[model samples]
Target: MYGRGGWARRIERRLAWSDSFVIVVVMVGAHAARFGWDPLAAVAGPSATPYWQVSVSVAVLWALQLGWARSREPRVLGHGPKEFQRVLIASWRTFAIVAIVGFLTQWQISRGYLLFALPLGAVVLVVYRAAWRKLIHAQRDRGDLLAQVLVAGPARTSEQMIRRLQRNRRAGYNVIGACVPGGSRARKTPLLEGVRVAGSLEDTAEVAMSLGAEYVLLSGSDAMSLREARQLGWELEGTGIGLIVAPALVDVAGPRVSMTPVEGLPLIHVEAPQFTGSQRVAKEIFDRASALAFLFVGGIPMLVIAAAIRLSSPGPALFRQVRVGRDHQLFTMYKFRSMYVDAEERLALLAGQSDGNGVLFKMHDDPRVTRIGRVLRRFSLDELPQLLNVLKGDMSMVGPRPPLPREVEQWDERVSRRQLVKPGVTGLWQVSGRSDLSWDEAVRLDLYYTENWSLASDAVIVLRTLGAIFFGRGAY
Candidate 1:
C-alpha cells in the first residue's frame, strides 16, 4: 500500500472481480427471461448457436471489452465522470461488435435480449462503479486509501495545489510535503500553512522517499523547463514514485482537451466548444419531457404552497422577474413569492447588510422574508415555479444560474459566456455552494458548465441538487 501505486492496485483487483460477477449475472438473467430452461434452445439463424452459449459468449466479450477500454483504471475509478463515461463507451462498443457479428454470420440476436442486457448491464456497471467510488470516498474520509504526495513547485503554486487537494479529499491526494523550484536559492522554511517546505526541486525524489510519498506532483509553471522535468523523471525512474504534472490549464472539461506526443513533447490541444448540435436538441427534448412529468407530480404541491404563501403574506403567490437567457436574450423568470410584496422596496435599506456574492443581493435573515418564505428558500421550493419557465422555453432543468439583468450588466468576458446556454432553475452554482460562492468562483462555475454542457452532466447536477437541498449548505 505504501508503494508507488499505493492502494490503487487493491481497489482495481476488487473492481475487476466484481465487474465480472455482475456482467455474468446480467447476461444469464437476460437469457433466462428470453428463453427460460432452454440451454439447447435453437437460435434464429442456422449459424447461430444455442441461446445459453450465445449469452455466455456475449458476457465474456462484454466483460473483456470493459477491461480493454480501461474503464476501471485507477485514475478514473474514484472520482469525476470519466469512469461512468468509459463504462457506457465500452458497453456500446461491445454491443456494436455483437451486432456486426450477427449481421455478417446471419446469427439473429434477439432484439429484446440485446436491449435488456445492454441497458441492464450498463446501469448495473455504472451503479457498481458509483458504489466503489462511494467506498473510496468513505475510506479517504476515514484517512485510509490516501496517496501521499510531495509537491514540487513555487511557493504559490504548491500552496494552491495543496489547498485544492485538501478541500476535495474525495480525490484521495494527500500532500505530505513540498519542495521549491530553485536549488539553493529557494528557502526551505515552511511558507505554507500546515505544509512543510522540504527542500529544492533537484532533491524532490529524495524528499519523496524520506517522506514515503507515493506520488510527486510537478506544478507546470515557468520555474521548470523541459530539461529539468525530463531529468527529474530520470531521477525517479527506479524510485517507485509516480510523477504527475499539474498543467496551468485548469477548470475546462476533460472531453474538450487532448494530449498529443509530438517527438517526445506532449502538446496539449483544447477543442472548441460546440454549443449547437444534436446534443443541444437532445437537451431541449429532455428538458421539456422531464419538465412535463415533474409538473404533473408537483402541480398540487405548488398550488398548496401558493395558498400557504398567500395566507402567510398579503402578496401575489407568484413572483415574476426578468432574467437573461441563452445568448443574452431576455425572459420572464417565475418563482414562488418567498418574500413580502414590499421586499423590493426594502432592498436599498438593507444594501449595507448584503451577504451575497456582491453582485447579487442575498441575506440569510432578512426582515422582509415571511415565516414560510424562509422555509421555502431553504429547501429550494421557491424555485419550483421555474418549471413553467422551462416549459415556456425560457429556462432549462439545469444550466447556468438564471441571472438578473443587474448581474449581467457587470459581466466580464467569462461571465458573458455564462449565458451561451439557457439559464436553469438549479445549476452548478446551486449544487456547488449556492449564494456562498464568491462572485468570481460562481462565474467560473457557470462558464465551465455553459461551455462543457452535457446531458449526462446535466443529469448529474440535477441528482446532486437533491443532496444540496437536503444539506442546505450555503442555500441562503
Candidate 2:
C-alpha cells in the first residue's frame, strides 16, 4: 500500500517534469519563430511587455493549470480517458484566460505564437503522459505497483469483485483479503482460491490496516448501512486508506455516470444510452470517409488477393453472406472466399468437431481452407471488402461484431441489444480475443460497446485492431 502511494508520487513528479519540459520547448520555439532571438527587443505594441516575459508567464501558468486540473491525481493517472481529457481541458482553459487577458490589456500577443504553442504543447504533454502510463501498465502486469485492496461485502459479491479485479490487471487493483458479514468466525476459511476471510464487516478498517491495504472496497451486498459506511470512512481518515463503494451498475462508462449530493446523501445518476444524435452523424461521416480512403489506398493489395484466391479456389473471389445489422436489418456482408466450394456442405460432417463457442463455428485445421485463404484469414486481409460495406452504410469502422442470422435467432433480449448499433469490420471482441472468446464473453463486449459507443472509443478500437491483425492474435 505504501509502495503504491510512492509509485503514484513518482509518476506525478515525472509528469510534472515532462510537462515543464514540453511547455518550455513549445513556448521558446513559438517565441523564437514569431520574434527574433533578442528577448529585450521583442516588445509588444503599447504595453512594451517583452515577448520572452510573456512566454515565461504563459509557461508557468500552463504548468500550474495542469496541476489545478488534477491531471496528476492517482485515481486517474494510470488508466482510462479521464487523465488525457483533464490535461487537454486544463491547457485549453489556460489559453482562453491568456487570450481574454491579452484583449483587455491590449498586450498585442502574437496570435501565431499562441496557436502554434498551444497545440504543440498539448500534444507533447499527452504523448509524454501516455508513455508514462504504458510504463506503469507494464509494471502492473508483472504484479507490481498495484493498490492492495480489502473487499468487504457478502461472499458472493466479494467473489465476483475479486474475479473482475483479477481479470482487468490494468485497473491496478490487487485483492489481498475479504471481510464479509460473518467473516470473523471463518477467518481460516478461503473465500476464493487464494483470498481468505480477513474479518467481519464491522472490523473492515482494522482488517485493512493489518493487511497493509490502501483501499477497502464495499460491495453492494455488504450488510453495512450508509451511516456505518460513513463511520468506517471517518475511522480510516488520515490513514492513507480510501473507501470505494461498488455500485450495481455494470458495463457503464465513466462519462455517463455522475454523482450528486442531495440532503447529504450521495445519489448516482446514470445517463440513458443514446443511439441517434449529431455524434452519430459525425461517426457515419467518419466511417464513409475513412472507408473510401482505405479502399483507394488498399486497391492494389486487394486486387492481388483477389487474383490469388481466383487461382487457388474454384469459387468466386468474393463471398457474400447474410448478416444481421443494426435494428435487426439483414445485409449482405462481403469477404474474400477462404473456404473450399464444398465447405458449407462439409459443415454437417464437421458440426460435432467444432472448436468454437456454441454459436460460432470454428476449426483450427478445417482442411477446407485454401492455402491462400489461410494467409488471408491470418492477417484479416479477407475482410478488405468490408470497406465497401462501410462505404455503403451497412457497417462501421468499429462497432459490435456482425452476427450471423442463425446466431441472432438464439439471442435473448439482452444479447439482441447488440443490434442497436451497426456491425463492424473489427471491434472490441475482434481486438480483444477474436475466436478465443466464448459466446457469452463476446456478447458482453458487444453489448458494452453498444451501450457506450463513442467516436474516441471507436478510434481506439481501430488502432488496436491494426495491432491485433499484425500479430495474428487468436487468428486461426
Candidate 3:
C-alpha cells in the first residue's frame, strides 16, 4: 500500500545531504589544516592553484562517486557490511581517479591535503553511515520502513522464508503474504499462522502488485520453469516491484558465491572456504601483532585487575586453565581469576543447578564469582590476560571461543569443525550472546565464522565485541 522506498528515499535524501556536507567540510578542513586558512596560500608549490578550488572538485566528485556506486541502495541500507564497503570503495576510487588525473596533467596536487582528507573523509563518512544505520535499525525494530514482501514458492519453503525474514527484522523484510503452488485450497488458507497464501505460483506478479509488495521472492521455485520465471519478471516490469530467486544455498557468504552464465543459463558456484595458506598466515600475523599491541596498552589495567582479584579472592591473580585450540591442540589459557580458589572443586556439587546454555556452565549470580570478579567479567577485563595466549601462538584475536576440553568432548562432527582454526579470546558467539545463546545457536555462529573467515569480518566482530562488553548483557 506504500510507494517503493518512500521512507527509504527520505533516509537516502538525508544521507545524500549529509554526504555532501561531510565531504565539503573534510576537504575545506584538510586545506585549512594544511595551509592555515590563509586566503593567498596556494598548494605546496609556487604559482600552484588554490587548495580551496581543489577541495570543491574533490568534494563534488566524492559525493557523485558515492551516488554512482549505489552506496545508498535500500536493500543494503539498514544492515550488513555491504553498505560500508560500497562507501569505502567509492571513496577510494574517487581519490585514485583524482590522483591519476593530477599525474597525467602534471598538476601539483598537495599530497598533504589528500593524505589528511582521504583517510579522514573515509572514516567520517563511514562513521556517519554507521550512525544512520543505527537510526534505521531503531526504526526497523519499531516495525517502520520495512519492505513489504510476498514469497512465491511451495508452501513449506515460503513458510521457511517468512520465518527467517521475520527473525531478522533488522534486514527490513516484512513478509505480508505468499503465493504458493496449490490447487487454491492452500490459497485463502494460513501458510504459517498470520501469513496466508495470497494466490498460486502463476498469480505471483499480479498478487505482488495487488498487495503492493516491494519484493517477490521465488523460493523453492520447482513448479516454475526458466521461461515461466522470465515471463513472471516480464509481467512485473512497470510495477515498481523487485523479483529475487532464493537460491538453495544458505549460510554461504558473498565472497564464496558467484554466478556464471553457461549457455545463457545462470549457474551458481560456491567455493569451499579455505582455512590454510596466505589468508591463514595473514590472520596469524595480525593476531600476534594486535595481541602484542593490546598487551602494551592494557598492561597497567590488567595489573590492577589481577591485584583486585588477589585482594577479593584467596586464589592467585592469574588463572591458567586447559582449553582446546587449533587442530585439537591442548593449550593453557590465561585469565584474570574471577572465581574463588575452590570454585572448580565445588563445580560438581553445583552442576545440577547450572543456569547455562546446557552444554556450557554459567551462572548469572554464581556464588563462585568473587566481588571484583563480577566487575572484571562484566567488562571482559578478566579475558585481557589471554592477549599473552594469543602472542604465545595458543590463540587468535578473533575466532571461535576456546572451548573446555570437556565441552569439546560432547560436540558433534559439525561442531568439531571449530578446531580447524585457533580459538580466540572473543568471537562471533560471544559478540552475538555470551552465556545466553543456546548451544546449537552458539555452534552455528562459530561454524559460520569458521567457514566465512575474513580479515574484514574479524575486524567487525572485534568492534562488536567492544559494544557487547560495554553493554554487559548475557555476560555472566
Instruction: Report every candidate's CA lDDT.
Output: 0.84, 0.87, 0.85
Candidate 3 clashing pairs?
A: none
Angstrom error of the Cα, residue 305, model 1: value is: 5.2
Q: Which residue pairs does candidate 2 place in steric collision?
A: none
TM-score against native, each model: 0.85, 0.86, 0.93
Model 2 TM-score? Answer: 0.86
For model 1, give the 10-residue run with minimal summed lDDT: 182-191
Worst 10 residues of 2 by lDDT: 39-48
Cα lDDT tens digits, model 1, 250-285, are 777746888999999988888888889899899999
The residue pairs that clash in candidate 1, if any, are none
**Candidate 3 per-residue lDDT over residues 1-476, each given as its tens digit:** 23355887887788899999989889889988888877566655445676677788888899999999999988888777788889999999989998897876677887888889998789899878877877888888998989899899877777777887886789988898998877266778777877887898888988888898998888885788888888998998988888888997777785788899998788999999898889889998999999989988878887877777777768699988999999999999998888888989999989988888789988877998888888888888889989999999999999998999999889889899988988988898888777988887788889988988899988878877876898896788
Candidate 3 has a TM-score of: 0.93
Model 3 gets an lDDT of 0.85
Q: Which run of 10 residues does model 3 get worst, by summed lDDT?
A: 39-48
The runs of at least 3 residues in candidate 3 whose Cα sits more than 4 Å from the true structure, single-residue gaps closed, are: 1-5, 352-355
